[model samples]
Target: MIVRVFGFSVIVSLSALAVAFLYRGWTGLALCAILGILEVSLSFDNAVINATVLERMSRFWQQMFLTVGIVIAVFGMRLLFPLAIVWITGGLAPVEAFRLAMNPPPDGADHFADGRPSYEAILLAAHPQIAAFGGMFLLLLFLNFVLGNRGLTWLSWIERPLGQLGRLDQLAVVIALVILVVAAEYLTPDSTRATVLISGILGAVTYLLVDGLSSLFQRRQPGGPDTSSVPGPPDGDCADRTDMQHGEIRSGEPARARHRPAPIAAAVGKAGFFLFLYLEVLDASFSFDGVIGAFAITPDPILIALGLGFIGAIFVRSITIYLVRQGTLGQYRYLEHGAHWAIGALAVILLVSIRVEINEVVTGLIGVAFIGASLASSVRANRRDGRHAHHEAVRTH
Candidate 1:
């Protein structure tokens, strides 16, 4: 089971490492290994967040997400994005940017002897806008997750109050945009302030656009929601005390599943497309930090892509699939909450990092901490639930 899901990732990682050895000997191989480890450690929470989405998708779409999505993450984001950033910011041609990235200046020197800023230096300079955009997008996501009407709550003291406040429509967007504006105005330097604001605004807008389209397509799907239940027997489903009948769709669950007509069933594919699109955009927002921070490990664009993209992205995607396949989220109720908390922490870190210098490893560790605590809590909850069930059986018997 392990090998079946992760076989492709393992193959890709091994092949990439082998190529690295051939390209630059043992030193290159070691660097790639370190970067891969770093990427995985930093992104374990991303896998959790991703699982929350991948579980809702069909098996076919899940396969596409793992295969084609990795191409975008590896080649498009890790490899080409470094070049694209340099090209766009430094007014260099694509070839020049690629060359510059390939032949990076020495560490500790911000500029080449010829006075051009080094590749890492250029990335650092552009960090404000990059952080702003990603920060706002992720902030919105975190807010949406935490503020939604959820069946379970990992942190009841906090989540319950926030969920109540969620009665105010669009509160998540309002909070995210306000923070974006405030951070852009106060955290950023005067020179980059407007740029940061614009980038952050664009990020918020992008999230709204993607999320809105996804919801629209979801609603239009035949098996999707049509109208809310009017009323029902007192002992119906836990949700709304009503049955999911009369064209009602509960959550992401579709009702077709080979029962509906061919044309109506086709809406499943269209709905999956929108979900896929949302996942991709959310993924890009998550990868921004890894891609940018990867320069600190090595400025060589090829190695960065090989380590972070080839090995890390593949393994992360595989982990997402594994969680979905194993029904980890359902079994361990608090995990999704913990992952969202990690995301919220990450969002805050990114937004603050526009001015502050927070180590990427520390940022990653915070996420690990939240997830670890959540895992422990889930275990305790499961044991307690088991005890209650056992006691009830004993008494009844």
Candidate 2:
């Protein structure tokens, strides 16, 4: 399974390394390699969140994301997107932007020749707006998930209350707006207040538009949303295993429904078109920090962008495939909970970073901590349930 999934990723990574060597010799190769590791470490939770969505997609769309999406990610987002930022913010012509990108300034230098802003300088200047948008979108995602009623959870104490409040209409939006206002008015600097506020609002609206369209598209499915096929602890079956354990039956649903394969709603069709858009937007948000942060290593825009795909992008895609293919969510029931919680933390960190510089390592560790704790909790629950099942079998025998 590992080889089948990661074989392509390995090939892509090697090719990228060779390109790096050819482009700038050993220095480019080393820097690109380090950036790859940095991206993977920082974006691990992104893979988990992405798997939750990808599992619902049909095979065609899933493969599309793996193939075509990689090209878009590498060239469109990694390469052209940064140049756009530099061009727009720094007021440079497209060709000039491309030229300046090729000749990046020295490390930590804000400007290059004639005191013009460097590509990195423009990106840093744009960070506040970037943070505002990505942070708000992610914050809303976390809120929407926790607000839904669910059977399995790692942090019941908090999640339970949020779930209870879910009945209120658009409660997540109300809360997000309030937080955004507070952050913009009080937290952000006076010079960038309007930009930050407007960006944050755009983020919230974008989430609503994309997510709402996805749900609307989902309803276009012939039989409605296929909620019954995923045989996990969700829907109140088992906290650690499939609900159909020991031939047990869930009332109101056929045994075959639980036994059916992963729910594939034809993502290549209308049912998944908007969902695909949502995933792309989510991927962009995940890469926002990494794209900006790569400057600390080297200012060469070409390497910074290509470096992401060298190893990081492919590995993330592969991990998402593994999780869905292996049904990791069903095996470790609280994984979804962990991933969402980590997203909430990351959202807050992104917002806070607008006022104060937060280390990327600190951001990564916080997410890992939340996921690790949830994994431990899930292990305990599984062990306890297994022992109970064994005792019940012994008595029956």
State in Å the error of residue 125, model 1: 0.8
313: Cα error in model 1, Å = 0.2
Which pairs clash in model 1? none
Question: On residues 61-91, what C-alpha lDDT tens digit does candidate 2 reach at each position?
Answer: 8988898788777777788888888888888
What is the Cα root-mean-square deviation between model 2 and the actual structure? Answer: 3.8
**Overall local distance difference test of candidate 1:** 0.78
Q: Give the TM-score of candidate 1.
A: 0.90
For each candidate in turn, the TM-score is 0.90, 0.91
State the lDDT at 297 in candidate 2. 82
Model 2 clash tally, residue pairs: 0
